[model samples]
Target: MIENRKYIVILAFLLIGMVYAAKLFMLQVVDDTYKRRADNNAVKRVMEYPYRGVIYDRNGAKLVYNEPVYDIMVTPREVHLDDTLAFCRLMHLTKEEVITKLAEAKDYSYRKPSAFLKQVSGADFARIQDQLIEFPGFEVVPRTVRGYPHKSFANALGYIGEISPSQLEKMGKDQYSAGDYIGISGLEYQYERFLRGKRGVKYIMVDRHGINKGAFKDGKYDTTAVKGENLVCTIDLNLQQYGERLMNGKIGSIVAIEPATGEILSLVSGPSYDPNILRGREFGKNFSVLQKDSLVPLFNRGIQAMYPPGSTFKLIEALIALQEGVIHPETHIACNRAIINCHGPHSFPDLRSAITNSCNPYFVNTFKRIINQEVNPNTFIDSRIGLTKWREYQLRFGLGRQLGLDIPNEKGGFIPSPEYYDRYYGEGHWKHSTIYSLGIGQGEILVTPLQMANLAATIANRGYYVTPHLIKSIGESGQPLLEYQQKNFVGVEARHFETVVEGMADVVDHGTGQYRAKIPGLQVCGKTGTVQNPHGEDHSGFIAFAPKDNPKIAVAVYVENAGQGARAAASIASLVIEKYMLGEIKRKNIEDYALKGKFVY
Candidate 1:
């Protein structure tokens, strides 16, 4: 019995040893979780940030590029500083700032790395990089910062900054981290994903002193960042620079578009700051100064400012009237100053002459006929019906609503509807005569400079226009946006545009706009407008498209507090068109006059 008991006890002990041995073998050879955990103590994972895409003008001029910058990163658990005060002084940081940063880093992760000091210039980084080894947890990480070679187009090119908490939440933590840079506005904001590229990760083995030995596992678990795709914009750098020069000391805007393609050539909002001011460490300070300046340089006036279209809108009315058959090319309207005072005296004139002379009474009378025609016989119903139809035609022209411009925060200028009038003046209280000012492009009809430029483009195209856009092509594939390629047709028939075009041509040939807008060989079609402003002097406005047949450029210029379009806006438009077409301005005298001209309220 004793022998049997001894054998039983020995077998039980053997079974226990086998179980313990098998468990040890499984943990050491079969499962990788513990092995990875062990590797984490000796390995560090670092992110590789790719270079942001380059931005170029239509002519392939580099507008924005990236410059190498270094950021000091830290891992809290690995930190072993020889002297905290010396380290703070080396990085140009206060001891309190260093402590605060360290605490924040600990809160993020003890083992993971985080940015400690960002955007250190090359000179500063060079001075301190040799000493970084003294601080075990800290290392210099290479990154890129946006750089502008020309420093112009601040409002159009935008700037980049560290990602905000809100942006991180929206972008997803997996895609972005706290230290990532993001585009804040303009084309940068519009194409961020394509410009930012893809980030990558690399794991490297580190010794007990937190010094990188080499890539972990011979770079088996490493990735290389993909460089961002390049962008080609539609802007003409030369024309844009010239327009900016002409608009110096001005408070308005200029927008030029390629009529056939709807591609914006130059969009200048005056009183702009150099893009360089919004880059580097001084951005916040410079931005605050610009924000407080009286000129409001940050405001994008081309697509955001609302102004009455003034007499420039008369071209549309003439076309709408012609399309409705309420008027003909030969039909004459006697200019009666008693009804609506004419800017100057003129006799009975046909459609073309009326437009050339800018006869206010003729347009008022023409508007009256369209509204009071015996369609409904009931005055209120007929007026409403007519106004509704007019609004429809106006909307088709890409007015009264956002044109879906690629830029952000475009305002839809107001075009009063029947309901809008009805709310203000009761159901049957209003008539065509009540709103006669609208016929001459006043009384609640408003448009941005961009829209006005588009109107000129639509006229240049004779009936259709594509939505104006800034991007010409994206990526190496040079793919143009499909939406901008599609045409948007106005309600007016193509045939009706001929009379209006002839009238515009006549205006430049011998009418109010003649003195300032005529080019020697270019047949420029243009109209002048002196918009009434209660707060100050009239705002000068002009719209033109040059070389009447197969037009190349359509432009709109607005000059605030300028007395007449002929004085400022017309001359600027003419110079811009001439410069673009002829490549050199033969009219140096005119250019000098425009550059030095002054206007008083």
Candidate 2:
């Protein structure tokens, strides 16, 4: 019996040895994962980031360029710091920060590298690189940070920051890792595909102490990093700078576009911060401060702030009335205060005179005839049908919808359709009277300043407008984008625009816009609006184009709480045009009034 038990024990021991041997073979020979992990200890993989594209103005002025920066990466398992205080001092970090970062890195991955410190300036990197060897497990990765030479175009130019976890996942692990910087807004985000170049990789061989021995396998697997494509933007640097200067200390936006090409000349969002404030270690802090600002300096008001188009929209109303055959250019309407309020002295005004005087009652009466054309016996049903047609025409004018501006965060301003009223006031319950303010470009009719600028461009073109774009060309191609080259006709006849053009010309020459919109030696055409605001004072608004025959520049300016349209908005628009066309502003009084916020109600 004892001999039999001994044999069983020996058999059991043999089975255990065989199981152990099989497991060892599977790990060492059959599976490559452990082999790769072992190789990772000695072979370091470094990502070679590409230089982001340079942004230039139309006339070849550098707006955004790159400056050298460094990112400090650490592998928790490899980190061996004997003098923690010395290392912290050299890296400009506290001992607690060092420990916390190491612990966090370990939580992420023991062997994988993670960013310990980000966006160290070139000067600071140069100072710290020599002493980096004193601390193990840490490596420096060279990178570039955007530098704004002019310190202008913050909201339009956009900014970059470390990618969030969600963005990283969407970009995919093959394309982006955890700590990659991505464009967050504006032109940066719009042109990210062209701006962010391809990333390369280098397999570096290192010794036991993490010292670089040489390139792994004689650089056979290493790839050369390709520089990003450069972009020539449509912005005129001089014009943009001058506009920004005029818009400073104000709470509004200015958008100017070349009527001939649809290329944006200048886009200024007031109370903007310098682009430099968003680049470096202080980014998070500065961003928080800007986000909390009461005026919202970070908001791009040009393409985002939706405001009532005010009387400037009267021009469109006249054109629609003309096209619908409800009202002619010579159609006269009495200034009936019972229908709507008007500040002008003109009692019975024609279409041109109504627009020139910004007679609200005329437009309201015109809208009434257009909406209540007796198409249907029921008032609500007729209003619904009329509003649908009206909305269609307004969309052709690029109102109440996104104009597809290249930048991000462009808001499609609301144009109340019959459906919208149905949703708000229930279906068939509302009529033209409920939405009458839309006639004077008030009530639910809203338009972004960008749309207003595009409206001026459309008027300047006599019937059509190209899609406004910031990038003139991409990757050294001097030609404008094909999409921006095609003119979008607003379904209005060219001859109809002539009557509105004359009215607009009179607006700058001798009407409501005369005080500030008139530019001497240049036949300026414009319309002004005192947009109503229940919160505070009325918003000043103006849209204009210069040299009535062949327009060069089209501009729209909106100033919040600035009272009459002839005040801040008209002055700013006129100044922008003078600087762009005449190469300098000779109207110091207009410039000073806009800059000093001197708007008298």
Task: State which candidate has the highest TM-score.
Answer: 1
What TM-score does structure 2 among the candidates reach? 0.91
Compute the lDDT for candidate 2.
Answer: 0.90
Q: Judge candidate 1 against the unseen true structure and give its global Cα lDDT, from 0 to 1.
A: 0.89
Poorest 10 consecutive residues by lDDT, candidate 2: 34-43
TM-score to native of every candidate shown: 0.93, 0.91
Clashes of 2: 0
lDDT of each: 0.89, 0.90
> lDDT score, residue 98, model 2?
81
**lDDT tens digits by residue: candidate 2, 53-120:** 99999999999999999999998887889988889889888888888888898999998888888888
Clashes of each: 0, 0
Every model's Cα RMSD, please?
3.7, 5.4
